[model samples]
Target: MAPILQVDVDALRQLAIDMAHAADTIHEFDLTQPATGAAESLESSSVAAISQNVSWSLREAYRHLAALVDQMATGTESAARIFEAAERSFTGALRRIH
Candidate 1:
């Protein structure tokens, strides 16, 4: 029996959510005048971090699914089938990343 254990997904989602909230808060601040330097820096960095987190999470999700699919493929199928399934998912994830 092959089992998948994922315990950090919530941490990843919460991190992204927090970054998004920070970005939104900074974005709404009045920009016509000099704003808090720390806030501006936070906004940019937080947005970039959120995007990176999203990209990484999405990639990892696909990789995890591919591995599971590969495991499923091998129950009564050849490695070629598993390879094809993994390739298909990897291709999809690559497309999504782009």
Candidate 2:
């Protein structure tokens, strides 16, 4: 198994807070049909439309989540790079000290 790279914990926490805040901004409403004389037929049509709309909405939501995840992943990668750089620098500095 490949060893997991260490990332800066603070960066991870910041990214999670950012993503959660962004996600919170999104508002979703129920797509229920209003009662009317033609409610029966409207219900059928609305059902089909609801299915399509929900699917589209879900797809869009998934895309947004994926983008957010990628952003977090990029931040994590940066943290990993910083950790590795700090490790190397400290190693070199220790050698110089000795």
Where's the lowest-lDDT run of ten residues in candidate 2?
A: 27-36
Model 1 lDDT on a 0 to 1 scale: 0.49
Q: Candidate 1, which ten residues in sequence have the lowest lDDT sum? A: 1-10
lDDT tens readout by residue for model 2, 7-83 = 55566667766665555453232223332333445566866566556656665776677677667666765775677
Give the winner by lDDT: 2
Please report, in order, the local distance difference test score of every candidate based on alpha carbons: 0.49, 0.59
Per-residue accuracy of model 1 over 28-96 as CA lDDT, tens digit each: 444323333443565757664555555556556655655554444343244344545666677777779
What residue pairs are clashing in model 1? Answer: none
Best candidate per TM-score, number?
A: 2
Q: How well does candidate 2 score on lDDT at residue 25? A: 50
